[model samples]
Target: MASPHRSDDLHQGDPVEDPPASYEPVNSDDALPYDDYEAEHRPPPTLRLRLAPWDVISTALLLTLLVVLATATNWPWRLYGFLSDVCTGETCGLVPFGVDNYIYPVVWGGIGAAIAAAGVGPFVSLLKGWYMSFWPVLSLTILMVSSVVGDSLTLFSERYWH
Candidate 1:
């Protein structure tokens, strides 16, 4: 229904208006009234890499300390384990007993993995599961791989260290 005060200019005595010469799409972000949000009090947004607002840099600076833990002299104690029927569920009587070489390797590998899974790596990812993109599991994988290839490198690198 037309307003009671409608005028002829508006097609029945209403005021005529001109169309806008320029068009600007209304963005949802901008559409929100600035006053509606407590922008002044809102904490700054942070990226997953930031950990706790600039903490990633500090964590990275101290990474040498963590990686150094893998250094041979720094961490000489190897975790060794046995493969008994009770532990591995195998028939052991017929075969000659072997040394328990697994206890240390896998133990260290898991320790490394746990660090990445629950420590700085996770914290660096803003504690989000998406940080798995960093391949946190690689921490343990590298330990296992190092245990194998490190032997080969030691023969060469050890020429000077030993």
Candidate 2:
């Protein structure tokens, strides 16, 4: 003996009511709004690796160290001469009279330029809200670890190669 308003209670043994015709669950995880036509034309997702400031700086530092280490290992006498001169001088004030005098500064300057260049793209990405800081920092850390291994190997080899 149910009133019309109490009809819902009479269906308690039945399955839950279906959604209303006009009801649209716009953002439900079970729903995908894209139709077949749109889905067919959609591009596949891609992963793009973009460099950041710190990544660039770390790369530059690693490159600079590699170059310096290689040169010193190959030409110990020349590196020793340069280090001796720099230590005794007020500053490395020697005229850029030859390759020997200019090479060290040029290498350092090149490293700086490389790092600066790396920063430019990431700065743009940061402005556009597409920047991810973690990857670059992670890459820098990897590069630093690799550089340490490389330097140690280079030193060990130099001992035998000499």
- The TM-score leader among the candidates is 1
TM-score to true structure, per model: 0.27, 0.24
Query: lDDT: which candidate is best?
Result: 2
- Candidate 2 residue pairs in backbone clash: none
Please give the lDDT score for candidate 2.
0.44
- Candidate 2 lDDT, tens digit per residue, 21-139? 79788677755444643454344554555657775565557555645654667533433233333322333233333323333444344435434444553565555545444334443
Model 2 TM-score is 0.24
Q: How high is the lDDT of residue 107 in model 2? A: 39
Off by over 4 Å in 1: 1-54, 78-109, 118-124, 127-162
How far in Å is the alpha carbon of 14 misplaced in model 2? 56
Evaluated at residue 91, the lDDT of candidate 1 is 30
